[model samples]
Structure formats: C-alpha cells, structure tokens
Target: MNSEAAIRAAQNQWKHRGAQRPAFALPTQPGQESVWDYPRPPALLSDTRTVQVRAKGNTAPIANSVRALRVLETAAPPTWYIPKQDIDMQRLVELKGQSSFCEWKGAATYWAISNASAQPVAWSYEKPRSEFAALQGHICFYPSRVECYVNDERVRPQPSEFYGGWVTDEVIGPFKGDPGTSHW
Candidate 1:
C-alpha cells in the first residue's frame, strides 16, 4: 500500500473511537474526567490552569504557564503543550537528528535541558498538520523525565516511553501505554 493508505490503515486500528467508553474503563467521579471519554483524532483545547515543568533536581521551573493547550485523545491522559514564550528557551537545546512522527500531529523535534543530561525531556511540532496547526511554537514535556504539574497537582507520566500523556487526579484512566493496551 502507498504511504497515505498505510497511514489510514494504521490509524483505523484503534478499536475505541471515543464515542463510548470501553467496559473496563474506570468510573469517573464528580470533577474527574475519564480518558475513555476523550475523542479520537484528539481535540485541542485551550487551558488556563497553571502548568509547570521543572528539570530533575532543579529548583527553578523550565516552563510555566497558564496559557497551555491540551491535546485530549481517546484512552490517553491529556498532554499539555505550553507556548514557546512561556518556556525558558535559553535552557533548552535542540537535539539534532532526533525526531519522531505522529499520524495526527506530523513531525516532532526533541529538546533537552542545556548543560544537564542529554536525554530529551521535551518535544515540539514545528510544522504540525493543518488540523493541529495551533500546536506550532508549543512544547510538551515528559512527566517521567521532568517534574510536571497542572493546577498545582503533580503529574504522573503515562506508562510508556513512547507516549507523553500527563496523568493527574482529575483525569482517570486505564490509559493507553499500559501493558496489554497496545491494541487500543
């Protein structure tokens, strides 16, 4: 199959399209959101809650903002994307030749804290697909790699290294990236 056809086929493999929650999904309490209820293809929503990111062992935050954009997708915790202006650009260095692609978001460029570990702690889409054009000039961090907080609550990293969803008390899940959830 051609590339476009292959992409479509792969995208179609997701069994839960988010129109309804799966049987195994945990019940959401009041003031909580179930990841299962988020839509497929994802939805980008503006968030005004304070979001913060700090490198490990650092007392100062690398990024903090109330103007974050959240990408919510089926069975995944929301990944908060902070505008470039809210981040400390001087402390970040682009990792050349390191990149990844998302079927929905297009290419991603990785970034790491300058003078710290070489491991990438964050990533951004410089030229996202039209559907996600708003994500340009925004960056998202891996909670596992850095300290991340949303509305003063610390975030837990999504279970897989390949996924960067941020988990907090407000979002409940049998989230994607956990063992045996690959088919979702």
Candidate 2:
C-alpha cells in the first residue's frame, strides 16, 4: 500500500477503535494559567542541545529553545509548541493541501518534513494569536515521532497521555474519555 493508503488505514482503525466523542475533562489550569491553554517550555531549556529531525537523509542540527508551548497530551504523546527561532526553519516546507480545524485555536496551516534523511513529519496549528506568536513559524514534535537530544544525552518527551505542559514534569494519567476529547 502507498503511504497515503497506510495513513488512511491507520486513521480508520483509530477512528473505529476510539471512543465515539470522548468527554474532554481537561485538567485544572494553574493560577495565572488559562484553562488548559498552551504551555511554555521551561526557562532553563538549552539552545545548544543536539536536536535531531527524523525526516527522510537529513539530521538537521536544532537550537533548543527555552520556549516550547504545550497544547495537549492525550493517551498518546505530549504536544509541544516550539518557537520558530529555535528551529532550523529551512526544513519546514509549507504544505498547500493539508489543514486542520480547531474551535479554540482556529484554522491550522500544515508543513511537511523536507529533509531526505529525516523521517516524514507533518505539523499543523489552528489559527494562533499574538500570545502564541512565538509558535507562528515553529513546529512542535511528537515525542513518539521525534527524538530530542541535549548534547550527547537524549531528552525524553513528557510521559502523560493527557497533558502538554512543557515545563511540568509530572505525567498525569490515562485520561482517555475525559470531557472534551471528542474532537481530538
């Protein structure tokens, strides 16, 4: 089967197996934080880390930013919001045909992985506001898809299946059927 076929098959399987409109009970946001809004990476993240882009012959070096934004963590992986300045923008090619709709964030633009050696990676963002302007050109990576490194040591993605705060270390829970996950 072709890549698109494989993707469609997988998506179909997931849709069939997943709960029909799971409830999305987002965790309570901390004081000063909006209700399950985007999260920012810790202030201590290093810019000199040895990041890897798992695309098709390219392992582009990346500048780690202290500014990753977390959108959500599901029964899958933690979603990170990266800043465009922290990434090697040359590898992100805007995709004309891919798009995703989000009620809160708005319409997202899609970008495909362009590196030959890096594994295929595609990213999208619903329309983001000025508060999220840092993420305008940046793309977040799925810990399941991309492996990050700090110097020679590998940095692990957050462990929660239902949370996406880049600065927090606790991986919350098996929140599959939580309140508003139907659209996820």
lDDT of 2: 0.44
Top lDDT model? 1
Question: For this target, which candidate reaches the highest TM-score against the unseen true structure?
Answer: 1
Provide TM-scores for the models.
0.96, 0.48
Span of 10 residues, lowest total lDDT, candidate 2: 37-46
Off by over 4 Å in 1: none
Which portions of model 2 miss their true places by more than 4 Å?
1-63, 72-77, 115-120, 124-126, 129-134, 149-169, 175-184
lDDT of each: 0.92, 0.44
What is the RMSD, in Å, between candidate 1 and the native fold over all Cα? Answer: 1.4
- Per-residue lDDT over 92-180 for candidate 1, one digit per residue giving the tens place of the 0 to 100 score: 99999999888788889999999988899999999998899999999999999999999889999999998999999999989989789
Q: What is candidate 2's CA lDDT for residue 91?
A: 64
Question: For each candidate, C-alpha RMSD in Å?
Answer: 1.4, 10.5
